[model samples]
Target: MKELAGKVKLVIKFFPYRYRDYSRIAAEAAIESWRQGKFAEMHELLIKRSPKLDRDSLISYAKELNLDVEKFTKAIDNQEGAAIIDRDLKLAKELDLYVTPAFYINGIKVLGVRDSDYFKNIIFKELENAKKK
Candidate 1:
């Protein structure tokens, strides 16, 4: 993404797994971190330390990231990101997405992990298509 920073934009939408025990809370923590401008850090921690997204773990991550722990905890306790999550869930359902790590490049649905070239090829194709318009 850094390579294509100026030519591309990345928009993240949450879609926590309904069956996972901590997915929703993790998503909430991520959203709260975003509010504090620490979204990337929290996201990296959450991914690196999966299945440990309990309240304590989240608070620890917040503290580690130097975020306002009080505000983060309050937001998590209040489920402040629920509405946003719900909205994104609805959109995911509409798109028939049932998996994590799904991405839509220029409205093209790509699932799971792939090499950078896989994405760059799609992005380049999309860029060309846009130019044709």
Candidate 2:
């Protein structure tokens, strides 16, 4: 993101795998943290620590980030972020996305991980295509 800077916009959608025990709660915590303006911090903590995304752990993370622990807990407990997750999940299903690290460049779907050049190549091609039109 820092490298791309103003050239690209990042949009993250939640897709918690059904098999993972803490996936749904983690997604809820992340979303609630976003509501409290600490998405990045919570995301980093969750990712770095991982599997420790239980209710207490999430509250501790919120406190660590100086977020409103009460609101955050309520939001997660009530599953207030379910709407957004549901929407993303539906879209993922429609897109037939069964893998993590999927990306779409100018309506072109690319699944799984790839080198930086692979993404840059797609972005450059899209930019060139846009210039033609």
- The C-alpha RMSD in Å for every predicted model, in order, reads 1.8, 2.2
Task: Report model 1's TM-score to 2 decimal places.
Answer: 0.87
Per-candidate TM-scores read 0.87, 0.83
Write model 1 residue lDDT over 24-84, tens digit each, in one string: 9899999999999988888889999998899999999999999999999999989999999
Best by lDDT: 1
Question: After superposition, which runs of candidate 1 have C-alpha atoms over 4 Å from their true positions?
Answer: 130-133
lDDT tens string, model 2, 27-112?
99999989888888888899898878888888898999999999998999999999999999999999888998788776788899
Alpha-carbon error at 48 in model 1, in Å? 2.3
- In order, how many clashes per candidate? 0, 0
